[model samples]
Target: MTQLTDTHLYREIHEQPAVLRRLLDKEEATAAALADLIHGRAIDHVVIAARGTSDNAGRYAQYVLGAMNGLSVGLAAPSLFSIYHRPPRFGNALVLGISQSGQSPDIVGVLAEARRQGALTAVLTNRPASPLADQGDVVIDLQAGEERAVAATKTYTAELAAIALISAALSDSAEQRQALAAMPDAVAATLSMNDAIAAAAPRYRYMSRCVVAGRGYNYATAFETALKLKEMTYTIVEPYSSADFLHGPLAMIETGFPVMIIAPAGVMAAEMAEFAHAVRGRQAEVIAISDAAEVLATARVPLRLPAPVPEWLSPITAIVPGQLLAMHLAHARDYDIDAPRGIHKVTETV
Candidate 1:
């Protein structure tokens, strides 16, 4: 077995708490300044352009910015700007580009087009000097330091923190800021359960296919978890919102089929718990990632979140266990985790 500390992915996973703290300490003012700029504009909606793990962070933004700030949020299809010559009008919209490396030409193209149309543009990236940053009216650095792992761990959470900081700043809520301030400790508490998650991962070593479900803000968590599982364990993992799972996909759940549920204690908790119960009634093997006892009780292998977090902020902490699960599961399956096959640390799509 590979020592957990020896892998860049593992080390980056453990670096999340400090990374988040650094973001909060350094970028709160930047986020607030961006919020002030937005407030001065007639920005009516938000369009976020990202890919892969960064796209998952944009999923979280759809919920946070939409729910907290009462603005419509949409994910931008970069192909409209890059592959096709036509880019949509960005009138009265705030277009944001999110990338860890800030090197994807397509993502930069979206921001560049948005800027050309005189729309407000912002960037969330670890690389301040990258081309994606060059086009932004405001650049909020992720401040996660150097993330060497091809599978993003610290940078993903840092992106989430940057988004949440902007949301909190836009709302101008002291309560929300207080919650943001506490997030690093919450993430640290979640990380302390690393041993438990590593132990539980081997049980799913032989599992080849599964569904990961979450609702609301954690819909992103489900997708991000599935991405990690695919990247590291080479498992066929599908992510779904718990609502969508029941719409039709639930038919695939047979006896002993694995379904991972992300059901934290929040407004979506009851619905997600009900979803878990329904999956259990189908006799599927439930692997739950949750803080709620009702949800965890249903899991054959429960990966519990030790700390309580606002559902909006839950995805940031929830993904830690998912990342750890992927890392340890890959170890159990004897796959090279530090360097996943067929993928590089920085993927630039045009």
Candidate 2:
């Protein structure tokens, strides 16, 4: 049996802090430059084109850019461009493409069309020279280096960081910059909980399916966490906003059913605590990833995030526990931590 520590996934999971620090150091200027270009343009909204984990990052951007920068943000439907050959007008929009490898044809095509229409375009990718990058007027390098794991660990967080950095740059808020600077430390602190997460993983070794819940910015965290669990442990995990879960999906919960809640301290805290209680009342086994005392108290397994992280930035640190949980759960189930059964590192869809 290969040691989990020897796996690419494990190494990359632990490499996140350094990767974030490197990204901030190297790409802050680029992010600022992109912000400057956006400011110079007549851009009014954002259209993001991505797939898989990158699409989840776009989810985060929808909230962050909309709330922070006052820009309406929408996720682009790449199939419309790549398959149907009918692309929408991107007038007065900042069209952004995000990919780890910058090789997805559909995503690249979206940016190409946006650029051809003279829309302002930007790309967040690890590869600055790949096809997707060629379509961007500005490129924000993720700086996560070469990720060998089929499931993205560092690049996902780096993408979130790049998005946050750009939003902060657009705002030119010193407080936001300070929060961004403190993110590496927050992530490092979150990484410290790995031992506890590892110890708790075996309890869920038989977990065949579950649901992940979050609200606000961590809504993206829930989706990304579900994706990681699905990829690494082959678990049937569904992600939902806390509001959405109550509307219908709450019916899926029975006694001892597993549900992971990503609830950090912020505006969403009270509502998440209420949702935690509601699910607990339904007799579901609550596995909470949160800094809130009430939510943690209600959890059968409380995966604590480092506290005092701003709500807007919480997704970056909150997802760490979920990644660790997936990795450790895969180890418990004796699954391949590096390569999941049916996926590759770069998936180019067109």
Candidate 3:
């Protein structure tokens, strides 16, 4: 059966890039504005609002900003903050809202409330001309170009780029900036593996069922990869952490089950490798994917990233693999690669 190429999901994934040219170029503006906003405002606290992958991006930024600069950065669900939770004190606060499309009603509401209470606002989105952008004091577009797929790809990476820049700007550290420059090259290296993934797709697509496992930061990568597989290949995919997989999720494992472990060779290597051993003992096929080479000879799918930088920086590098897997699997299954089932480029929920 030949794969159809007209679906929105197809085009989006096919064209998905590690370094979206325009979005990459726009980082300076976003960073400059963010820095100016915080540098001048005598900032009191920081709040980030996002949903889906953007939420993960927000969480990454929150962790980076707070740890790197001692800034009080926190993550909040847009709907919960506006509809249920009280707004944080705003006079000295900065509100950072992230969404691929700047039109979600919940996001719009949260940003509006933050502004109404005196918080300075910034919106990071692909659509700069969106309604939510209308509400922002500054609009930092991802410049990911037209993403036709319902599941985000370039936009997500672009969001990270935008946030990475913003985080770097808020702190007075050159190390952060140096790390950012190295990231794009690492992303490029990851992209080079796409062809390798394409060659491996037939093996993945025929598998009866598969499990993707990870720990700490890579857990998000694991879950997102599972979602891509489910959305693209209609595969019976489950994502579990290394620790939790042994408890309950592992019981379902037997001879035929294939396990893909995302152990990115940083903080969680020891524990992840141990989980791999347990999975192997169960007589299940284990495929260990890592930034370092620690898995047993027969189980290794080593992803050689640009040396395990900081843990915070590791997630950005790992995203490249998830995108590759999703695209290739979808292509192998002959499913629509661009517009997936029941996905909107921009989700506007109240």
Candidate 4:
């Protein structure tokens, strides 16, 4: 039985598929215009600046831009300009500032300076009229209206859609767009598993800490899911790429410690399956989000994807179940689903 208690986060999560479709239908022209600017200026490098949830979106942007356009992508350290007052050369770069509220002082500071340094600056924000949007040479609205929840469900997916749209436009690949067209349907199917995920919540009700792992394009999913768990459930969660996990963090797993793995069917699936088997060998609880039968079989608790989604577009769909797990786990533990401690809708840091 699905929990009947209604929360802002729960409502927003259900609203994502509609919001994503609207973005695809409406943002086609805007995405093309941004692509034109990229080509016209001959951007050689890409730099993205964001904070909190938006930074996770920026991480997805890094992977998409690198894989699709073959451009060098780097995440900006806002403190370099906001705190130290040092400006690096970005004359031939495309700098993107991502903020859901478009009100973050430091993110705007980085974009303002990037523009001053002769870089082509763009912003992906829900607010088109905000100061951060004003800093953009071009502004791509997320089209996620008035997100009432503090934890950010619709807005985060909106950011991923916007970034994926930009990447597809830059490449001018109809095949990529065709692949992306499957996302809304995939997301819808994922939402149908909410009841199942909620039922599985008790398995992690006592979970105090965990590791979220992924690789390649879904690496950002790992980071974002861990962020959601920490923010809403107050769990001490660490996120890592599968390779990074092997380096040192693998030692942290004790007997029966919860380990959440996002291993969608992709080139990285086999590698992730191997890691999952190894974790199970350590007696840690393996909670896997995957569509691969082999990976699913290796897990103690399986939260399956609806279909075999393409690797390039997996992050947008794969993260939905993770978000549901975090929300359900928090609710199961009696935490406030709408408001977590010491956090606000818009975080302003300088």
Candidate 5:
């Protein structure tokens, strides 16, 4: 059985705060350039193309851009362009491609097609020289440096911060900018919980399967956390929106089953509290990651956030403890935290 080590994955998780700070300090000019480029075009809508962890970031973008910026954002289906050879009309749209490596053929193809179709194309990637960078009219480097771990840690949060910065730049809102600026500190604060999260990992060491749930902005965190557990610990974790869980998935809960909930404070707080009550009635173990007192009260074991973050900004800070949970769970289960079976840093998919 493998024990915990100073793995690259662990290092990358701790490096997130520095990665975010580097992105803001060094990439300010690049973000400004993107703002200018976006302003020059008449963007009537938004379409983001990504896969895996980047796709989770895109999901957050869809919510933030639509709710805060008043622009309808859609997640692009690259298969439509790559496989069917039928590219949607993206004219007068802001088409953004997000990738950690910037090497996905389908993602790059979609952005290239969007650019040819007269849409304003932009790219967010850690690699500046990758193919996707060339496809975009404006490329914003993630500045997360090199991510050596197969299950992305720093790169994922960097994408979230990059999206937030882009949104702030687009709106020229001082409040939004301030929120984005404070995120690094928030993440740094959350990292201090590594000892606590690691101490609690033994409780779920034998967890073979579970459900991860969240809503509103933190819904993306639910998906990403489930993905991390799957990738690292080989856990069969299913993620759902709390509202959607009540539809059918709720029936899966049994007495002693585990249900991990990301319940940050905001508009979704009350609904999450209600879900917690329902889970309690089922006799399932509700492990909640939240800053809300109500949510903490309902959880069997609560991993509280370091600060009370608003829903819009919660994704950035809320994800840290979950990421740590995945790492600690992997270590507890005696799995290699740096490299999972049958996965790589860059997944090539068409």
Candidate 6:
């Protein structure tokens, strides 16, 4: 029975309120150590590390900070702090470790080493009591609370928001702060599109697999979206560069295999459109998210954002539809969205 309460998948949509409530109290919910670091000042480059969804958020942060404030940002494998990829000695570097649970050995251990080398450290995590906190110079609590869904929906949004706040603080501009402040509403509005996305999910459910592609910020979302679909829907989804897809992956793309492209109206807009034509020749389905005119394709889905934003932050918007897609698919399959198989809220990878 598709009763409202029984729909485990829609719980993701319902949980939207919980995420919004937590975000509103940002200061109260924020981690003291992370806030202190921001106030302490004096930071050079920002370095980040994480494995899955967290890694995508880290990549988003780099784009936000670098494109918005023109700051130098770097992302490292947490193993960089150990032998082989040993941590670089730099007092000015700020290491940012992202782990929802805050206990992953790679993130925690590398953060400890970065601190030892005098690099400022910060964490994006949901667990305040996590040992990873002990190693951080600053800790930005994701405030995503307990994400029961193994596929990860809200935490990804929270972590990205936290990163934007941290980046805006570093940019130290009132304009940036205002932009960051407006994000909660932007996100809330984005989530409101759940119905539209739910309507679109069935169109691709018959397909065995699909692809998500983009460049820069949306590139990371492409990767994250693919990960979410596989984790939540038990479906095969691939993340690739649009250009790279044309060079190779496009060849294997048959009628049933669709392509989900995040075609942002950003720096690479023209090149992106050209790439879309290549996929067209393969007779593959193309679902593009963009503000420009929609292209005709086997399946063209146009995502409409309210207005233009900093190009780096555009992917932040691109991801909302993808999240809704994952949610709808889970519902369609009558699967438990709150607890997907073979995963957990915080995978403290052993």
Best by lDDT: 2
Error of 6 at 94 (Å): 0.5
> How do the residues 199-245 of candidate 3 rate in per-residue lDDT, one tens digit apiece?
76677777657899877766767776777777767778888877887
lDDT of candidate 4 over 70-159, digit per residue (tens):
888899999988889886777699999999999989999999998788789999999999999999998988888899778988999999
Each model's Cα RMSD: 0.9, 0.8, 3.3, 1.5, 1.2, 3.2
Q: Which parts of model 6 have CA positions greater than 4 angstroms off? A: 1-9, 12-25, 28-42, 80-91, 294-299, 306-309
CA shift of 176, model 3, Å:
2.4
Residue-level lDDT tens digits of model 5 in 89-124: 986898999999999999999998987887888899
The candidate with the higher lDDT, 1 or 6, is 1
- Model 6's alpha-carbon lDDT is 0.70
lDDT of model number 5 = 0.89
lDDT of each structure?
Answer: 0.91, 0.93, 0.73, 0.89, 0.89, 0.70
In candidate 5, list every pair of residues with a backbone clash.
Answer: none
TM-score of each: 0.98, 0.99, 0.84, 0.98, 0.97, 0.86
* Model 3 TM-score, 2 decimals: 0.84
TM-score of 2: 0.99
lDDT (tens digit, per residue) of candidate 2 on 1-350: 78988999989989999999999999999999989988988579999999999999999999999999999999999999989998999899999999999998999999999989999999999999999999999999999999999999899999999999999999999999999999998998999999999999999999899999998999999999999999999989999999999999999989999989999988898899999999999999999998989889989998888656999999999999999999999988888889889898989789
CA lDDT, candidate 6, residue 90:
55
Cα error, candidate 4, residue 227 (Å): 0.6
Model 4 vs. true fold: TM: 0.98
* Off by more than 4 A, model 2: none
Residue 97, candidate 2: C-alpha displacement in angstroms: 0.2
Query: Candidates sorted by TM-score, descending order?
Result: 2, 1, 4, 5, 6, 3
Inter-residue clash pairs, candidate 1? none
